[model samples]
Target: LIVCTHDLAVTLTQRPHHLIEYLARMKKRVTFLHLRHLYEQPRDKGSPYIRKKVKIGGVEVRAIFAPFPSPLLNIFRGLCVLLHVLLFDKHRYRVGINQGDPWIGFVFYILRAIGVIERYVYEDLDYNPGGHKNWLFKRITEIAEYYSIKVSDLVICVSLNLLRLRNRWRINRVIYSPNGVHLSLFSRAIKKKAHPPTILYIGSITEYFGLDIAISVLPSLLKKIPEIRLIIAGSGYYLDDLKRIINKYPEIKGHIIFLGRIPHEKIPDLMAESDIGLAIFPPSELMHYACPIKIFEYMAAGLSIITTRGTEAARILKKYSVGLIINYSVENLKEAILKLFMDGCLYKRFSMNSLKFSVKHDWNKIFHDEFKEIESLYLEYVLIHKRTVS
Candidate 1:
């Protein structure tokens, strides 16, 4: 069973899509419980439970939806889960995978204590203890995180830096599983037109993502390369602020285009049409340890990457010669963009290297390797438990 914070129907990005698709392909029996808050009130006000049967990769999957707005809703959802476990799960479930949701982890811990679940895995993709604006809320969530980490049989993290928490948390088993991309989907031939060179920025439009810096450097870039254009995709809380900043610079407005939140399927085509990919993130603890999915997707699409320094993705770029890393400043970014645009050989080399590096980091390979480790650990635990019982 996989429990996550987003509904699979609304968005299939990040952890939810990757794990569900991989499990379906492996022909494993998987049930996904989506505990997401609905923007509008659910139609069934009496019963805020919704169920769906969906198919991914031709494999049938059971999806359950529950409202997760408050503590009361979470308690109700826990009861729903307990009922499902007792009535439907006749064969005891061997593993439960919870995606950093403390409430879900608490419920699974209860199930494990009752012998319904043998063990549970905690997947932590992001380590943002101080991300919430509400200090009380942040502290509560952090406590929940600690509890989840303590109770989990196996902890899976997307960054190696997170392994440092093993010693701090007294955890025995931790695995580093970085983000990956679907190579085949992004294997379209790069466009070979003599039009204006396009620099593309995809994913969320948040302040920390450094899209504002990209916008700030565009005026300087336009002067050097008159035909260069900037394309910004995706939407977030900072979208209006970004638009306001752009409005201040009417001269470069024609050179910049904003494509609000794009569908996941259309990203590949958009990448293929562009010359460069921007993976800039602000210099912060959270970003320094992050394995951004956009970086891998850019590589798979064969775009030369321009990213901020000190990130895990930047380390991979440096090791593989797949992209250029610059200081998180407007001047440095402007200089790097101009250098890449002016030098044809350097751009070609990085573009080719990006594609070559992506072959090793495909989603298929990363998940297969992690799954093997998980199985081995489970088997070892079973053997030890039997010996102890005897």
Candidate 2:
């Protein structure tokens, strides 16, 4: 399989990592082509291309971290993919993962057309255009995504809403495969620590995640549990804004700890120390069709969740009773926070429920079932064609 993604799997563990890792464990011939942007690349760079055996959570992430002599724009990334297939890897792949950037998605689809790969699997992780604010980039991605979906042999959507939306767009080959977590990597449900009943908010520090609203209510939460802590991991554009919001309440200043851009390996330790795993994506079109991987990761860590309505995380909690859902308000946020930390029995129940839920949503199990279903469907379709010919 040839996997193409914009994110460096070795650094930030994401959707592509799980599938690539699964393929590697199965001993398949896998060559991953990924991106390393200007901001992320080293200052004294020797070569533009970096192909090495990198590891995530101690498991090897074999890849060609490709970026040409310029910015992380789609055009350059597309050129890198061409270089990788033509001059670098030079081997035909059975499965071509049209994963990450839309520019690469079109390239992979073309590769499939030319027999560079036998099948094209379009990974509809997110509506890239919807997430982008730039008009030109959005239009480019929208066109690329439309063509990719039309030409793909199979399409995997990360959420049910996305699946339905894609199907409505006339994609019959699409299926739902929500974001999953590596069970072995994330230590599940360590007993609640005695000091500082901690609430953890990890992943991209973006505005839509609803952390600001959660933090705004912290002053009220402090009235009951004065020593309660909120540890925020990961860096994003919203870090400065979040800090400004935190500064509004100087009383809760000591309670907040910011550990920006954590390594993948250190995440489990953070989870182990945390009392609650937090995800609160506010209502939006993009978020509505979103499946937050953090929800599964939190469950894998056996930490109870507190999320907002109209997200996949909320639906998961609604089904499993693993946590509470709050509207985008200070009062509800305060109430939900108190329940998880203050109510021992309820917290235990939610923790146990999360543990059980995590097992079912493990990356290994999810991929196994998904691949099995794909194989079965292939076989059934082939048999029908044979019968028709006979």
Worst 10 residues of 1 by lDDT: 41-50
TM per candidate comes to 0.88, 0.85
What TM-score does structure 2 among the candidates reach?
A: 0.85
Q: In model 2, which runs have C-alpha deviations exceeding 4 angstroms?
A: 9-11, 39-72, 134-140, 373-390
Off by over 4 Å in 1: 41-51, 57-91, 189-195
> How well is each residue in 108-129 modelled by candidate 1, as lDDT tens digits?
8988898777788888777655
Model 2, range 1-390, lDDT digits (tens) per residue? 545555453244577756767866766555666655545532212222244555433233444445543323556677666776777656786666767456666677668678787667777888776776677766877887787687777888888877888888898688888888888878634544455789899888888788898789889888899888899987777889988998899999998999977766678888888888888876776677778888988888888899888877788889888998888777888888888887999999998998887877888878887777566655665688699999
Index of the highest-lDDT prediction: 1
lDDT of each: 0.76, 0.74
CA error at residue 52 for candidate 1, angstroms:
3.5
Candidate 1 versus the native: TM-score?
A: 0.88
